[model samples]
Structures are given as structure tokens and as C-alpha cells.
Target: MGRNRKWIQICILLAVVILGGWTIASSVLDKTEIPKVGSKAPEFTLTGLDGKTHQLSDYKGKTVVVNFWATYCPPCREEMPDIQKQAAKWADKDVVVLGVNVAESKVTAKNFVDQLGVTFPILLDSKDKIRREYGVLNYPTTVFVKPDGKIAVIKEGLMDEAYLDRTIASVAAAGNGNK
Candidate 1:
């Protein structure tokens, strides 16, 4: 009985050690160093669902909402409609919303966009190069870029329409003042 109890204790200790190590590794992998606010936004060129190349410099004189998302992320899906609504609100303004789909096929991204009925442009990052450039470790990360091509804000997870609108407004205000 004593030998059996000792064996069980050893097994439990080994299991705990293994589980703890996995948890630490998982956290480390998910950890990302997001760009600081007011820093110049990283430049990247990706192909859009429309088959046209899109470079960050294309919208140099506009405030852009660059969002990194995936089809499987629930929070990303949840914020799609809000983002669409905000896009329409800022349509006449110098604001553009670019949805960057990370590591997904054109077909999958097209299906998702069709299902959502979104009018905004969805760019495909099949190689995850753009995502890596932006340092996105989360499913739904957003970066607000100013007219000068600098990052104004980096929001992780789902963002509300009100907050998005406020960020756009702030960027627009700053852009106008710079003129």
C-alpha cells in the first residue's frame, strides 16, 4: 500500500509540472508587443478581396482603421456590424476602414464577407506577413492610423462603435489642425 501511494504521488507531481510548463508556454506565445500610440504605423502591402493591391501609403492623407481579424474569432464576428456602421458614418469623411483577414484563403474571406453583407474592403493576409508586421497576437486587434501615417491607438479584442467613432473624430481633428 505504501509503495502504491508513493507511485501515485509521483505521477501527480509529474502531471502538475507538465501542465504548468504548457500553460507558461501558451501565455508566452500569445503575448505580443503592440506598437506604442503616436508611433509611425508599419508599412505593408497586401492583396484585397477585390484583387487590387493595398498599401498603407495608399491612404496617406486619410485616417485609417486597420483591423486584424479571423473568421473563427467570435469577438471579430461580433464587431463586424459595428465596424460596418462606422464605416458608413465616416464614408464622406477622410476616414477609411481596412479589414485585414489574417492567414485565410480568399474563398473563406469572401464567404465571410458575403455572409456578413459588409461593404467595407477586406484584405487577405494569407502569409500572415501583415499581421506579423503589426505585431498582432490576438484575434481582433485594431490600429488607428492618422493622416500622417502614424498610429493613434491600438485596441485589442472587440471595440464598441462609440469608441471607434471617438477615435476617428480625434484623428480627423488632429489631421485638420495639421493643415
Candidate 2:
């Protein structure tokens, strides 16, 4: 009877340990949701491909598209051309498109940009500080900031050219109206 009781106690203790561990693990592994529209976009300063520093607040009077991406992400690669095209179209306007590469080396990002023929500014987040500040849980996440420095839109995953164009136009229009 004593041996049986000891075994039962051990089993209960093991079950509690397992259950507690699972609970903690699940919470830690859960991905956080990216910020939503109408929120103040997190400010950051990162080095662009031209070796110049770009700050989110620097484009205060203009609309900005801040895209978080990486070289290894398929979705990020898919949206590169679209972002490049949009940047070209809005080059003369009061608009800036910043492609922030998260946790990747300068050489890797440069190679990817050259291969893809992308002309837009690709900023480097070497320490992933901006990623954590923005709660970027997925690659190819884009946040559209209005001229007022508030987030106007948040797009996750891959976005096509048409969608980006429309979003840019809308944001530009809004900025113009607010001016």
C-alpha cells in the first residue's frame, strides 16, 4: 500500500510539472498581433542601403510606407517589385517608402536587392530592435503612416501592386487634404 501511494504521488507531481511547463511554453510561443490603424506608429532610425541613416520621424510632413521584411521570406521577396514600382511612381511626391530588412546582414540585403533590381531604399535592422518595438510577428508586414505621423493602415503578408497603388493613392490624398 505504501509503494502504491508513493507512485500515485509521483504521478500527480509529474502531471503538475508537465501542465505548468506546457502553459508557460504556449504563452511564450504565441505570436503578438501587429499594431492596428489609428495607432501611433513606433519611431525608429535605421541605416539605409546608401549608408545613410533614415528616421521614421524625418518624414513627418509626408506619407511614409514602412515595410518590415527579410531576404529569406518568400512573401517579402514577392512584394519587392511592387514596392519598388510604387516608390518610383511616388518619387517626386511628398512620399517615402522605406523597406526595413530585419536581422539581416548588409551584404545579404544588397545582393537580394541587386538580383531583384529593386531601387527603393532598403534599411537594415541589424539588431532587430525595430522589429521588436513594432511587434512584427510576420515577414512582409507594412505600415502606412499618414503625414500626421499616425498609422493609417497595417498590411500583413504579401500585397500585390494594385493594392499597394491604391493604398498609396489613398494615403497621399488624405495627406494632401490634411495639409
Candidate 3:
């Protein structure tokens, strides 16, 4: 009986260790496994407020800014104007700003955009499918894609006009490098 009890304890301890190791490994992998800066940005197709579907692949050869935001998020609301301004700054260039609204209704997103006077395309991610694909866990996450479809940067949180301009400039510089 004593030997049996000891064996059972050993088995339980081994199971705990194995489970703990797997949990830790998975979390570490998630943290370090974000999309690479120079790798191809993940492609997604979502409908905009105008009822037109927009695909990332469609914007190939154009520098695209994919910003994942929600209408109710304060930081997301704050950064919308800056994103709009930055997009306008590069209007003549081959650049497009896409604002992806995560898990928000079209009516809400449309109202918010109209209220803010946003001129850029606002894509709807009603189910948050695209948001999950982009690994955007925070509000106002911005992913800058270079003209070659490669990712230039992924910024998480509220972005000011200066930061957005700097990031756009970096993408432009990266685009020049590819040429």
C-alpha cells in the first residue's frame, strides 16, 4: 500500500510539471511570435461603411496603414484625427489609411467617423476576426505596411500626429529602400 501511494504521488507530480511546462511554453511563444517587421502583412478582406469590400491584397504596391480601433475606446477616438491628418499628408503618394473598427456595429462606426469628420476608409470588423488575425489585443493598434506589402511597424496604443508622421516617413523611407 505504501509503495502504491508513492507511485501515485510521483505520477501526479509528473503530470503537474508537464502541464505547467506546456502552459509556460505556450505563453512565451505567443509573446515572442508577433508578426515580423519585414514579413508580409496578414491579408484580410472586410466591408467598409460604404458597403464595399476592401482587401489588403488589393492595396498591393501602396503603403497601407491598418489601424484596429473601437468606437467606445477613448484612445482610439483620440488617435483617429491624427491618423486622418497623417493619411492626408501623404495623399498624393501611394498611401492609404484603413481604419478597422473592431466588434462595432456599422451604424456606430459610421456615426463616430462622421462626428470626427474622418475622410479615410473605415473598415468594419464586426466579429473581430481580422482583429484577432492581426494580433491586435489593445485598442488603437496601428500596423504600417510598406509599398511592397511588407510590414514596416506595429504600434499598440494611442498615437499622436507626430508619431504617426514619423511612422509614415519610416515606411516611405523603407519603400525608397526597396526601389
Model 1: ten consecutive residues of lowest lDDT: 29-38
Can you tell me which runs of candidate 2 are displaced by over 4 Å? 1-34
Tell me how candidate 2 scores on lDDT: 0.90
Better of 2 and 3 by lDDT: 2
Q: What is the TM-score of each candidate against the true structure?
A: 0.79, 0.79, 0.80
Model 2 over residues 1-179: C-alpha lDDT tens digits? 99999999999999999999999988975645455688788788889999999998988989999999999999899889989999999989988999999988899999999999988888999999888888888988999999999899888899999999999899889978988
Better model by TM-score, 2 or 3?
3
Candidate 1, residues 1-179: lDDT per residue as tens digits? 99999999999999999999899998986675456788789888888999999999999999999999999999999999999999999988989999999998889899998899888889999999878878889989999998998888889999989988888899889987887
Ranking by lDDT: 1, 2, 3
Query: Per-candidate RMSD vs. true structure?
Result: 12.3, 9.8, 7.5
For model 3, the stretches where C-alpha displacement exceeds 4 angstroms are: 1-34
For all candidates in order, the CA lDDT equals: 0.90, 0.90, 0.89
In candidate 2, the residue pairs with backbone N, CA or C atoms under 3 Å apart (3 or more residues apart, or in different chains) clash, namely none
